[model samples]
Target: MGSKNISITEDAYERLKAHKREGESFTDVIVRLTEDERDIMSGFGAWSGTDKGDHARKAREQLNAEFEDGR
Candidate 1:
């Protein structure tokens, strides 16, 4: 594949370099950082079939009770 030259500030270069893993190219780091294109509904139902939902509900209930009690 052909590559093009682009200019970036020293600070920008340093930041990108910081994110680069050992034995990885700058192109690989750029792709890895920018390739995440998630849908809005991707996280829907993530807590389903888990006790996390119940825990959140109980926490909300406790907060509401405390608010009603003016504490």
Candidate 2:
């Protein structure tokens, strides 16, 4: 594949470098970091009908209560 040159700040380059494995190129690190990222919309309805869903619901209620209480 053809490659393109890009620039990043030193901090960003260091962060990416920290994630690079011994045998991985910068391209490999970038692809691996991003490849499994999920769209936020894909999570809609994902928790329904599951025990975790109930937990999440309870957590949301608690958070809402705390917010209402101005805590």
Best by TM-score: 2
Report the Cα lDDT for residue 22, model 2. 97
Poorly placed runs, candidate 1 (over 4 Å): 39-71
lDDT of each: 0.88, 0.90
The per-prediction tally of clashing pairs is 0, 0
Model 1's alpha-carbon lDDT is 0.88
TM-score of 2: 0.62
Error of 1 at 40 (Å): 5.7
Runs in model 2 lying further than 4 Å from the true structure = 40-71
Residue 49 lDDT in model 2?
Answer: 69
TM-score of each: 0.55, 0.62
- Pairs clashing within candidate 1: none
